[model samples]
Target: MTKITHFWAFFTFVAFSLGLSNCRTVKNGLDEKIYNG
Candidate 1:
């Protein structure tokens, strides 16, 4: 049970980091479009 719980935490952290990076990329793209237009 403890091992499973630790794995779950690690998985959640990785997923969160990926999500954050994706959001940053999207935000930067939008900013660039606005700047160019």
Candidate 2:
């Protein structure tokens, strides 16, 4: 049970970090588009 809980916590952390990175890239893309246009 402890192992499963640890795994779940790790998975959630990884997913949250990935989501943050994705948002950063998306925001950068939008900034570039605005500048170019």
Candidate 3:
């Protein structure tokens, strides 16, 4: 039970980290285009 809980927490952290990374890149891309153009 303890191992399962640990795995779940790690999985959740990775999932949210990937999502935030993706969102940040997308946001930066739009910001660059808007201000540089």
- Residue range with the least summed lDDT across 10 consecutive positions in model 1: 1-10
lDDT of 3 at 13: 100
lDDT of 1 at 34: 100
> What would the per-residue lDDT of candidate 2 be over residues 1-37, giving only the tens digit for each residue?
9999999999999999999999999999999999999
Encode model 1's per-residue lDDT on 1-37: one tens digit a residue. 9999999999999999999999999999999999999
RMSD (Å) per prediction: 0.6, 0.3, 1.1
Model 3, which residues run further than 4 Å from truth? none
Worst 10 residues of 3 by lDDT: 28-37
**Which ranges of candidate 1 are over 4 A from the true structure?**
none
Ranking by TM-score: 2, 1, 3
Decoy 1 TM-score against native: 0.90
For residue 9, model 1's alpha carbon misses the true position, in angstroms, by 0.0
Model 2, position 26: C-alpha lDDT score? 100
